[model samples]
Target: MFRKIRILLLLVVLLFVALGTWRSDSRLASWAYVTRVAVYPVAADDSPTTAQFIRELDAASFAAIENWLQREVKRYRQTQQASVQIRLGAEIKTLPPGLPNAPNTLDIMLWSLKLRWWAYRQEDGENIKPHIQIFVLFHDAKRHVGAALPHSIGMRKGKIGVIHAFASPEQTGQNAVIITHELLHLFGATDKYDFATLQPVYPQGYAEPERLPLLPQTLAEIMGGRIPVSRERAEIPKDLSVTRIGPTTAEEIGLLAP
Candidate 1:
């Protein structure tokens, strides 16, 4: 009789623990999630131009990016009555060395754990604890730079990401677009563009699929490749001004009910 009682007690405790964990995870996924993000700049290349560009990095450089996020949240809230927000934390220094440039699945998990520990140790008490960390690595224009890990989003412990771009004043606006793209990936948004043809998909990818003439789209969907110039062609927007979140993306990110 005592053995049976002990087994029952163990099961009861396990059930309670599972319930508590589920409730906590549900709260994080709610519409009121206000995620805090920190952006850090690093010179990927050792060239003089890249070094100088990294030196010019400041909080002001990301102001437009922050503003764009605010506007997007506000727009969605007004239309769908969802109250999600993105709080941009202060710009921090580059992360420590030894982080993998091209991490595999195991490397990603290990790197995320190391990054969270490193960030917490670097905090000076004045800075807010970020829910997400974005490491922006700047490279020279001569170097071909086209790699941002969408898989790095929404890791265990915390959300972490990386963006690689050219180190030039002219590329700042375009870089902001890329940053915003990766930011959405952290919130469960998937890509809407085709990998083979690099064109935005139909219906879900189109910003205004209900329009009479769907040949030319006025705005680019945030998850899509770019604004559609034709049924089969699209062009990258110069900045976030020409980008807007589509209904599919908003629903995926919990900003709208499906």
Candidate 2:
């Protein structure tokens, strides 16, 4: 009877040890949460008719932004083979310029650190506050009149990787790329395009782990943003190539991956 009891106790301890090891090694250990986005209204000075027009445009812009975000989440999931699912919320109220130095000049910028933290804390369990990212598009005109403007992500570490954009609704199409670009920045992905020359930034080691090419210039990689290739032939740049990454890049940064 004593020997049997000892054997059972030892088995229980070993089971717990194995469970702990599995949990530690599991790639899906850190549960992936959904991203919630809220678009607060900014200060604008236009007539009621103009206001209606702006509202319509804003609605369209919101749709485009949501669609783009979903697309990016899908792409990332495919590449990473991650079990972490991304949930997204609707476009909510727009925030007023809280800072004294902030522009009342039809352009709004969200400092990733500021009051945004409060926004998350204030929420009830009714709304799960996953990592949040804010996207802002600034335009002075009728909200649909201007060239698509280029934006720069602020150097400060961003939560939810906010991108404060300044552009008209007509130019908002390119804003999708900008939004995804900023969000990815939070994930430690570098830009494939160099800001200096306004050209592609093709470093040999740009793609990590998978050695996937960063652009069409080398191999067939989505990081290059090439998709829906023609049925007949897929044209990729000869210079682009991929290499195998053995525990570096994301894993090195401790992104809680599988």
Q: How does each model score on TM-score?
A: 0.72, 0.44
Q: Report clash pairs, candidate 1.
A: none
All models: lDDT? 0.70, 0.39
50-158: candidate 1 lDDT, tens digit per residue: 8888777776788887778767876777653333334334334554435577879999657655765665565534456666667777778866546542222333234
- What's the distance in Å from true for residue 85, model 2? 8.7
Model 2 worst lDDT window (10 residues): 238-247
Prediction 2 global C-alpha lDDT: 0.39
| Candidate 1 Cα outliers beyond 4 Å, as residue runs | 1-28, 31-33, 79-126, 145-157
User: lDDT (0-100) at residue 123 of candidate 1?
Assistant: 55
**Candidate 2 local lDDT, 211-257, one digit each (tens):** 33423333322232222123223332222122111122234323435
For candidate 1, report its TM-score. Answer: 0.72
- Highest lDDT: give the candidate number: 1
